[model samples]
Target: MKLLLSFFLIFPLLLSSQSFEKGEKLFVEGKFNQAQLVLENYLKSNPNHLKTLEYLGDIAGQNKAWDKSISYYKKLENLKPTEANYYFKYGGALAMKSLEVNKIKALGMIGEVRSSFEKAIALNPKHIEARWALIELNLQLPAIVGGSESKAIKYSSELRELSPVDGYLSRGHIEEHFNRNTEAEVQYKRAILIGGSKVCYQTLADFYKNKMKQPDKANKVWEEYKNKNNKGIK
Candidate 1:
């Protein structure tokens, strides 16, 4: 009888596991709305399901629902304060929100954004994304707030140690921001050569289109990028 009771007790957990697996598979298959519904329903019964919360946060981010993303990530932050990725995601969402708000509100939110990235790096020193995000944020803000090219350079140095391609990209962003077209082009080209990511290709293409005044070169690069991606389609 006790063994039978144990089986009954375990059955609900088994169902929950199956449900979560199905939801996660749906998410991976790009059925994000369906996955969100399934996961949200699951979270009703399992309120503290950290994985579900994380996915909800990511889904919100994909949908560009910055407020929802912030809520979900903040919950995850409270649940797992030591998690570096949660802070990074939370900061990113907040930064996005800042852009939608007025200047005064954006100023405060920007500070929070920087603080979150700082915490993320403090938790995981080698977090390349967090480091890069911080560098970009510092470069954009004014000197009165947190804008410091020197700080951006420091983070760029650390990123260089972590990833040469990302280091070049950061330097390119710095140069581009300061309107140094020739230097920016050189750094961006080096970044593309070092890393074959879509961001690298797009960055150089944009530089050519806008800064270099070489629309033909930009069109060629963009066409090649589209062709390369289309080849991967099933």
Candidate 2:
């Protein structure tokens, strides 16, 4: 009787495990709609399952269902208050939602969006993406509303200390945004020299083609990258 009772009690857990593993596999394979169906069914039985909620939140975000994404991430943040990533995802969802809403509503959400990112940074002092987000936010917002080049540069400087490539790229981005093409070009070149990665090369090439109107330079940049990569220079 005791053995039968133990098996009965463990059966549901085994089923749940199989269900979630299938759902996670589907999610990893990018069959998000199918994964969502399976995961939602599992969630009905395991409502507070953290990985299930996280995968659902990611799928919702991928589908551009920002409100639903925010709801899941908010629950995650509440459940795991010390987890930096949950706060970051919650803030990212809020930021996307803000973009979809009216200007007044977006303005209303700004404080919370900023706070969530800040909270993530507080929890993880070395959070690179959070710093980048703050840099962009400061640069994009109107000066009257709180935008400041100095603030953007502050984050860029921090990035420099963390990763030289990101620092130069971000500084270049800021300069490009301010219409300082020459300064931007200098920064981008520095990044390519230091990193020589695909993104670094692409960033400089795009700047040359689009911003500086130099298609020949862009082509040359691509060719250079191909040649250097073939030679195993980077």
In model 1, the worst 10-residue window by lDDT is 225-234
Model 2's C-alpha root-mean-square deviation from the true structure amounts to 1.3
Q: What's the lDDT for all of these models?
A: 0.90, 0.94
TM-score of 2: 0.96
lDDT of 1 by residue, 109-142 (tens): 9878998999999999989999889888988899
Give the alpha carbon lDDT tens digit for every residue of 97-134 in model 2.
99999999998998888889889889998888988888
Error of 2 at 215 (Å): 1.6
True-vs-predicted CA distance for residue 85, candidate 1, Å: 0.4
TM-scores of the candidates are: 0.87, 0.96
In candidate 2, where is summed lDDT lowest over 10 consecutive residues?
A: 139-148
lDDT of 1 at 159: 89
The lDDT leader among the candidates is: 2
**In lDDT terms, how accurate is model 2?**
0.94
